[model samples]
Target: MTTPLPIGSTIGILGGGQLGRMLSVAASRLGFRTVIFEPGADCPASHVAQAHIQASYEDAAALRRFAERVDVITYEFENIPTSALDILEALRPIHPNREALRISQDRLTEKTFLSNLGLTTAPFADIPDAAALDGALQTIGTPSILKTRRFGYDGKGQARLSSPREAAQAFSDMNGAPAILEGFVDFSLEVSIIAARSQDGQVSAYDPGENVHEGGILRTTTVPAKIPARLQTDAVLLAAKILNALEYVGVMGVELFVTPTALIVNEIAPRVHNSGHWTQNGCTVDQFEQHIRAVAGWPLGNGERHSDVTMANLIGDDMDRVPALAQDGACALHLYGKAEVKPGRKMGHVNRVTD
Candidate 1:
């Protein structure tokens, strides 16, 4: 077993988005300091972290300095530059590890990994060129979605085709990037399990949460997913299986599709996830805290839910409703300190808890 980080040790976090902000907050609560290495100035996490290194990921000097300052490393996002990671890994240990990042960074790789594990996922094929797209369209059929293999999230880099006639326009949307064609699944609802694994291979999973997405952006996630007990158990077990396969030492979000018969794997996020936000008010150990604990080599915390929670995201202009949302005594709001809120951008989230 790896030694747990001392209380006052500093943790280096990559990316300075809202996830990093929340992770920093959780680390502080655990008596650890945090430093953020993100290029963007005045990023959300920079506001709360002990220090912020505003430099490009290509700056090996900056990455080395950042790594030297912290005892361990973790990241908020999966699309981190390989060069940046190479430098940091040589200096300090990175949790959730490079293998997890390598798999999650590419859609094709992630799906292949899941399928190889005896997991059910959307029927998919690699699309490296127009010919490959045609080949995939022939086998996968229509009513499918074309997604870039890497760097896609929140519905970006995705194009839908109702028929092969629309293939040209859909493939054009990829802009020459390597893509994957995923046949749409007929499912009842989407649910996600937020699971964590410690350094010693111990695994724990919070109850799955039902999710709703609009315009490809997550809108709300409700705890205690409205699924059968057997399915719920299956979701948790599948999540644990994924974490253990990767020897993942951090939190992971596994999204699944519930069909009439079985659950299909949707995708997995290597870092803390938006759908797991309900854990803030619903569980003793929220996902962010659990992530920090795992990366710090501390024992995984009890994540049993205590309250039923429905978490709603405040997207872009939705920030206008903050006044009304704040009036609700039962709602707990977590706002990201983003100065400019563009359309579809996440500004904050509200967890409405019920006893």
Candidate 2:
């Protein structure tokens, strides 16, 4: 087992979004301070972190200074530039490892990796150009999605093609970026497993959560997913296999498509996930703190769910309902201190304990 960092140590967090904001709060609860490195000024995490470094990710000098202050580094998002990682990683350890980030950063690479691990993923083909789109379509077929290879999230950088004629438009939507064409799956429901692995290779996973998405953005996640007992066991084991394969430390979100015969892997997020937010109310140790604990080299926490919980994201106009949500005693509100309220922006989330 890796030696746990002593109390009062500082953890460096990259990306000052809501996930980083909640991570900072969780670190504080464990007697650890957090220093946030974000390019944007007054980011959501800056409000609660011990210190915030406002500089671009590629700024070498700023990264050096930030690394010098913290004992370990972790990121809330996966799209961090390799140049920035080269600098910070040379100075301090970054948990979940760069390999995990590298694989998850690209759709093609991620699918290949999962398949190599004896896992099932949607039929995928590389689309390097418009010409490749036609050839890819011949194999993967229509009613598929064309997604950029890198830096896509929350339904962005993707176009759906219903037929072969739409292939040209789908490739055009990519704006000449490298892309992947994925065949559609006949899924009964969507579910995700939130798993954590300690430095010593100990792994634990929370119960799978059934998810609902609207306009390509996650809307709600409910624990005690309506899956059969056998499938639930398969979900947990498959998640553990991923953690082991990556030799990963810290938490990972594994999204899956539940089919009649098998569970198909959709994608994997290398950090705390929106789908796992139900853990906040259902489990004694939520995904955020579990991530902090694992990266800090602490023993993994008990992630067993004790109650049924449904978590709903507050997007755009959803903020207006906060008043009514606050009055409900069973609801736990977690609002990100983001200043602007734009359409489709994730402002906050509420977890309602059902049991």
Candidate 3:
């Protein structure tokens, strides 16, 4: 299918993180130009893009100029302000559409959407205020999680309540924002499926990646998850259903909880995802390229896996381990050109492919 915007046309991208960086690199390979709109002066994505509009998300004039220059737009992150999207969409097309963005931005809305679709998820309830928190606790129980409805990522803006005493403190710590209390599930492992939906509504999903997290941050993701083949097929079908429901057009990441009873939808990321980094070395068509194809209205590429892979995130001081990691013959080390290595920061990743 030919895109509304053709190859060699410029694409505007929101956010300048590592995901945007990879998207820009992929766009360049496909003969498309990328104009990155980011407020920061030296973001990782700006290094690769043809143009960088250095302005805040709320800057309407800058946004208008960016929209005028690019043919179509897409974002790397879901936390983009709604007002900013309003401004950009008035000028150019934004893929995955506003409903996808709206559903993905809030945990409560996301859970409700999944439930409405008959998808299993952790039991959850809304916490409107301090008074509501007690009721939520009673309903969802202790050993549960309390997360803000919006703008939480990388384990930030969330608290676990194992005891009644921790509940009020968790509420107070969040500055009394709207929140959700979710009952914890006993899962064998966490997994995620990354899939792409093209302009013609065709969907293709990569093999699910089994993930392990530490201190609220992703630690590693291994493909061809050591799970039953039928379960993996179920995961892919669920993800495709989600994308098709959203009428989504671009790459999306669906995190899942592989429980004893069923696979539950954990969360949805409406763009290229961290757990999918292994596809860089393991798939015939990587998630980044697939996103570029979908948003540009090009044909989706093959999403076949070539070899089993383990993708390890480089967090904070983990950068120091690069030399040793690079020495391994099977490891492909990818570093984000960020100068400082702060705790919990995702600097890069290493994909180790094995037979």
Candidate 4:
């Protein structure tokens, strides 16, 4: 196993979203310096990182410089360009590795990988063309969803179909890109497991948190998910299986659908997840800290929960509630430093911890 990067070492981060912002905060707590590489100025992560690389992901010269300056690298999100990774990997080590990124970037590849590991997922098929869509619809059935093969997140690039006529419009919405048609799952509730794996392959997972979404965007997460204990255990086991399957060496979030008879894999985020934000106040070690430990080769910390917590996302205009939420007892408010409150945008979140 590779030795952990010691305290005071610089860690490179690939995205500048809220996830990167939280990772920077956690890394600082462990005495590590962080450098953020992103194209946009005034990104949320740029506010907390030690330094910022204000350049595009495809800027090879800048990427090389970033790789030279950092001891190790990790990303906050999965949508990073593959070519950018090639340049960074040549100069520095990237945790979770490129294979994990490639598999998770495409919906069909992720579903196939999970199925190969003996995990249950929604019935799905590749949609290569309009003709293929007809066959896929016949097999996967209607009242399903058609998702683009790549770059889809936060309910984007997905279309719902209640009938055959809707399939063509859905395909057109995706601009005939590589896509997958997935049957809708009849689930009782949705939950997610936040898990970490060390470089030596040691793995640990946190309790699944129940999730509720608004307009397809996550709105709230509550710990001690109301579900059978066996299903909860299954969630953790499924997350471990995914981490092990990818030989992943960082924090990963696995979203699952708990049904009457079984558990079905929904989607996997190969990094710290928004749903796991409750961990910041609820657990002994938050997902962000665990991610830092795994990528830095440090010993993973205890993930025990000390409190019952509920996390509410401050999306768009919800940021206006910060003043009132901050006044509440036991609530920790986190603002992402985003300038705009555009519809559907995530501005921040608040966690209420109850002992």
**Model 1 clash tally?**
0
User: lDDT tens digits, residues 147-210, model 1?
Assistant: 9999877788999999998889999999999999999999999999999999988899999999
Model 3: lowest-lDDT 10 consecutive positions: 1-10
lDDT of 2 by residue, 83-187 (tens): 999999999999989999999999999999999999999999999988888999998998999999998777889999999999888888889899999999999
Candidates in order, TM-scores: namely 0.99, 0.99, 0.98, 0.98
lDDT of 1 at 173: 97
Per-residue CA lDDT of model 3 for 83-197, tens digit only, reads 9999999989999799999999999999999999989999999888988889888878889988999987766888999987898899987887899888999999999999999
lDDT of 1 at 335: 100
Runs of candidate 4 with Cα error greater than 4 angstroms are none
Off by over 4 Å in 2: none
Better of 2 and 4 by TM-score: 2
lDDT against the true structure, per candidate, is 0.95, 0.95, 0.92, 0.91
Instruction: For model 3, state the Cα shift of residue 214 in Å.
Output: 0.4
Q: Estimate the lDDT of model 2.
A: 0.95
Residue pairs of candidate 1 with colliding backbone atoms? none
Clashes of each: 0, 0, 0, 0
Candidate 4: Cα lDDT at 130 = 89
Report model 4's TM-score to 2 decimal places.
Answer: 0.98
Task: Say what the RMSD of model 2 is.
Answer: 0.8
Compared with the true structure, what per-residue lDDT tens digits does model 4 show for residues 1-355? 6787888999999989999999999999999999999899989999999999999987899999889889999999898888899898988999988989999999999999999999999999999898999998888889999999999776889999999999779999998689999999999999998999999899999888999988889999999899989998888888888898889999998999989999999999899999999999998889999999999999898998889999999988888788888789889998889988998999999998866
Error of 2 at 27 (Å): 0.6
Q: Give the C-alpha miss distance for residue 282 in model 2, angstroms.
A: 1.0
